[model samples]
Structure formats: C-alpha cells, structure tokens
Target: MVPKAFEAGYPKTLGFRKVVKATIYVKKKEGMSDEDFIDYYNTKHAQRAAPILQRHGIISYSLTYHLERDRKMIQDIMHGKAQLMDYDAICTFVFPDYLALAKFLYDKDGAALSSDHDNFMDDKLMKMMVGDEYLLIEDGNKVG
Candidate 1:
C-alpha cells in the first residue's frame, strides 16, 4: 500500500518527482561454486539491504526473480501503454526530492551495497542497473 502522504504528494510532485528502478540478475559460476549468491540474496542480503535503504529515504522497493508470468507482464508493458523495455529485479524509490535520490544512490552506503554485490557476484552473472520514471499506480505500495 502507498502512504497517504505519497498519494497526496505524487501528483503535485509529478513533474518534479523522480523515481528510480534498478535490476540485478545473478548467475552462478561453474561447478556450482557460486550457489551462495542465491542463498545470500534470498535470505540475508534483502533483509539487511532494506533497512539500509530505508535509512536513505527509500520510500518503497521490492526484489523479484524472473518468472514466466513476469516475462509476459514485461512484454505486455513494453508493448502496451508503458514502453519500458528492460529490467530484471526492479527496485523503485520515491524520495522526498530528486536530489535525495541522487545523493542516496551516490552515497557511501549505496556505494557499499554496489561493491558488496559485485564482490559476491560471479563473473557469469549478468548484473545491470537501469533507471526509469514511474507512475504510482497505487499509493503506499511499499509500506506494509
């Protein structure tokens, strides 16, 4: 669910507001040596990462793996109204302002997160980060 404030503020901030989404894809190394990557992401990493991001003013986000239905949905969105073409894991952020988002992405914590992921990720894994503008289809979508 989206927060009341975000619902009220989104439209007003539409032109001024900025939303960022990043996708990270993981692949294991040969001989199953990199299986730990999956375990880390599915268990500890996400939980650990969430609080850190929250501290940086990330209003909402989620981590997801690719599924058949997800592929279909992405195809539909790309071919349909929204022309987004690429992404795997989508992390959405609604900051108080654009600068906050920029700062958070460039800050020490953000850098550490990036580095940590890179350090653990196998060379075979294809990781990428892409940014995009988002429309809030619903309010407080991230808050539980």
Candidate 2:
C-alpha cells in the first residue's frame, strides 16, 4: 500500500485514470532457501527498487507473500482441485500516469529493473500488465 501522504486529497469522483500495474510472481531458484529469497527481496532488492521507482514516477509499490495458510484455504475452496495460481509472491507497482509508465518502460531505468529481476526473479514465471481500476464501491457507498 502507498503511504497516506502519497494519496491524493480528492477522490476521483469521475472514472479513475489508468495506471501501470506491474504484478510480479517470484520463482525460487534451485538450492536457494525460501528465507533467503524473501530476505533478499525485502531487504536488498526492494530497497534498491525504491529509488528507481521514485525516479520513474511510481506512486506506490508493495509485495504480497503467498502464505501456507492461504494456500490451504485455496485448496479447501477448490475442493482439493488444481491450484489456481502458483507463485511465491505478487508485487504491485503503481504509476502516476500512462505517460510516466511509458517513460519507465522505454527508459534505462526499466533496463536496470529488468537486470535486477534477473538476479532474483524468474522471467518465465512472471506476469505483468497496466490496468485501470473501476471502483464499484468505496467505504460501503456505491461508486461509479
């Protein structure tokens, strides 16, 4: 989640503008412990990414870990069916605007991000996209 200070003072009473949403899925490399992978991501990788994201005009960045308990709940909901998603973590990167996102995509900073991903992420297992959010409800009130 983004820091409260970063949130705009006014809500988008109109439709929300589209923003880049880079959702990342991590694949733990062979022989690397899960603890090590998470530590490097949270400490070294994420730490390094903050400045780059800021420079690229990203609004917020956050990581969601796939916990064992959540996995069990998924299995239960599926009635012992197949796994819906197989990934260790999901990362969301929000950009201020599509133009800012485009700049990041075509700039050297993007290359740096890609290079860093090579060190800790499996490109083959990754899924990313830029999307707009449609708010159906906000604070229990209907929204456009």
Error of 1 at 130 (Å): 6.0
Q: Model 1, which residues run further than 4 Å from truth?
A: 1-38, 67-88, 119-144
TM-score: model 1 vs. ground truth? 0.48
**Residue 38 miss distance in model 1 (angstroms):** 4.1
Q: Supply candidate 1's per-residue lDDT for 77.
A: 75
**Per-residue alpha-carbon lDDT of model 1 for 1-144, expressed as tens digits?**
444433323454443234544455554333433245456665765666676677767767665554345667877977856544333333344555455556677778666776556544454456655454455444856421
Which residue pairs collide, candidate 1?
A: 1-140, 1-141, 2-139, 2-140, 2-141, 3-140
lDDT of 2 by residue, 46-94 (tens): 8877887788788889988775666788789888885657777888888
For all candidates in order, the CA lDDT equals: 0.53, 0.70
Point out where model 2 deviates above 4 Å: 1-17, 67-69, 76-82, 138-144
Per-candidate TM-score against the hidden true structure: 0.48, 0.71
Error of 1 at 67 (Å): 5.7
